[model samples]
Target: MKQRIITAVVALLFFIPLVAIGGMPLQLLAAAMAGVGVYELFNMKGLEIKSLEGVLAILASVLLVLPKATWFNFLPDTVTNITLFYLIVMFILMVPVFSKNSYTFDDAAFPVLVSLYVGFGFQNFILARESGVTVLMFALLVVWSTDIGAYFCGMKFGKNKLAPHISPNKTIEGALGGVICAVVVALVYLLVWPMANYNLLIMLPLTAIFSVVGQMGDLVQSAYKRHYGVKDSGNILPGHGGILDRFDSLLFVFPLMHLVGIF
Candidate 1:
């Protein structure tokens, strides 16, 4: 418990500053996250990655965040699609060349995983910034509320398991508590400063639904760790575990917010 507090404090101390600075700093932070995440994704034991797979991962990630081709006039069209096709074309063209390491199909999944994890997940932050910081802040707050609320509620009153296989710690009662806390947080934020330019009536419910998504995100990550026989993704973030651990909910929430136009 004491260690968790210290970890949370240290994380906030680092996170608040980077978020406050915005712009390139934020981009750099996202890039670093993507790079590390991709590296970890590729590091799955018994997984085989091709020589150009790393290049594809980086390309997919950058293009996802980069400015639209409309600005440069010389930029290529369908950038994401083209890069994806590069994979398909390469696989089909080179299948005969591999006498061994026949698990090409398995290795290919890593790039897609990395591409989506870093691209779609982080792209929402860019969109959120354009809309307003409050947009991002609220999304983040709800995720936190869920995480905090669930922990306390579960320990005290939880009965039914949320996902016994993936995450034994989670409970259905805890999930309800998280929903309640998230709604309360949203209402308080609304009272403090009414959000403009978005429909709260619709957004409130959507945000609650998104809180559920974030919890599932945590569950999925936990399941991955369980499968790999690891306690966490990496040891880079002290008690937090890894970048993925610190931002699991954020990763799920960001794309959801973008889809709903709340960010």
Candidate 2:
């Protein structure tokens, strides 16, 4: 518990400043996170970090994230998007040609998927921040509220399991508690940022929806680790686990915000 609190504080110290800057610093942080996340995923699959496919996977992950940096603002969005896609396709093609069976279809495909998953997910963070600090901070705070609400609520009143096989700690009551908590936080934020222009009725459902999505993202990462026969993703953050473990819900929220045109 002490370690967790300490780590959270340390992270906030670094994260708050990067978020305030809202540009290349944040993008570089995102790239570093994606790199570590891809490495952890590869580690789970028993792959060498320095292997041909592994290096490509990490590099691709970093590259895919770079286009979102503030420096790349000069380029058209269409150009950047297409270029990354083309490069990813070429990377996949080159895998089989350069090294037969050293990297299988699944092996090659995994990194690309991770690149899209982690890379584009964080890219959306930059997009969200660019829209407004309030938008980004609101999304983050809501997710955090959901997690905290669910933990305490579940510990006190949980009964029925939310998903026993995937995450035994979660409960249906806790899930409800989490959604309600997120809605409350959203209301509070809107009250403070009164010019938000979002109706309470609409905000309630949106918060509830994203709260559920955030929980689903947690379950997905849990399932991933279970499939790989592991517990935590890595020990980088001590009690907090790895980049993926910490950002799983955040990752899901970012893309969803984009889908809903919030950013």
Candidate 3:
């Protein structure tokens, strides 16, 4: 518990400032985080990070994470980020042929899918920050409130399992508690810094929906970790696991926010 708190403080100290700055620095941080997340996913499958597939996956994710302004300056406008990403995907798929089937198509599938998942997630993260610090912080607050609410509520009032197989510790009651907490926190945040375009009645329900989506994201991560037979994603953060572990909910929430026209 002490270690967890310490790590959280240290991380927030480093992360909050970058998030506040919100430019190339934040974009670079997001890209680097996406790369680390790709590394963790590769490690879960027992793939070497130095391997061809791993490098390609990391590169693809970084490319996705970076904004157009940064990359377009160097590359021709004809070659969009999506084009580069698809090219990388093709290269990853072709690795099995050169390796004489030592690296199977099945092996290639993991990195390809992982790159898309982690890549798009972090890409939207940068998009959220670019929208405004308030917008990004609103999303972060919802995710964090849900997590904290679920943990305490599960310990105090939990009687039914939410998904016993994927995450035994989570409870249905706790999930509801999390949604409620998220709505409340979101309400408070908006009241203090209300957006001109936001409708309070509509936003409140949206907050609850986002909270549920964020929990689903956490469950997805838990399911993958269970399949990999690991306790945490990685030990990058002594008590918080890896970048993926900490940002799983945010990853889901941020992208969904964009899709829903929040950003």
Best by lDDT: 3
In angstroms, how far off is 169's CA in candidate 1? 0.9
Winning candidate number (TM-score): 3
Q: Which ten residues in a row have the lowest lDDT in candidate 3?
A: 68-77
For model 2 the TM-score comes to 0.92
lDDT of 2 by residue, 180-243 (tens): 8998998898778642546667777888899999999899999999999989888898889999
Q: Report lDDT (Cα) of residue 45, candidate 1.
A: 41
Ranking by lDDT: 3, 2, 1
Question: Where is model 1 more than 4 Å wrong at Cα?
Answer: 46-52, 66-103
lDDT minimum window of 10 residues, candidate 1:
66-75
Which segments of candidate 3 are over 4 A away from where they belong? none
- lDDT for 103 in candidate 2 is 64
Task: Report the C-alpha displacement of residue 206, candidate 1, in angstroms.
Answer: 1.3
Off by over 4 Å in 2: 72-78, 194-197
Clash count in backbone of candidate 3: 0
lDDT per residue (tens digit) for residues 1-263 in model 3: 99999999999999999999989999899999999999998898788999888999999998888877686667777877778788899999999899999889998999999999999999999888878899889999999999999999999999999999999999999999999999999999999977555788988999999999999999999999999999989899999999999988988888899998888
lDDT of candidate 3? Answer: 0.91
Q: Please give the CA lDDT of all the candidate structures.
A: 0.72, 0.82, 0.91
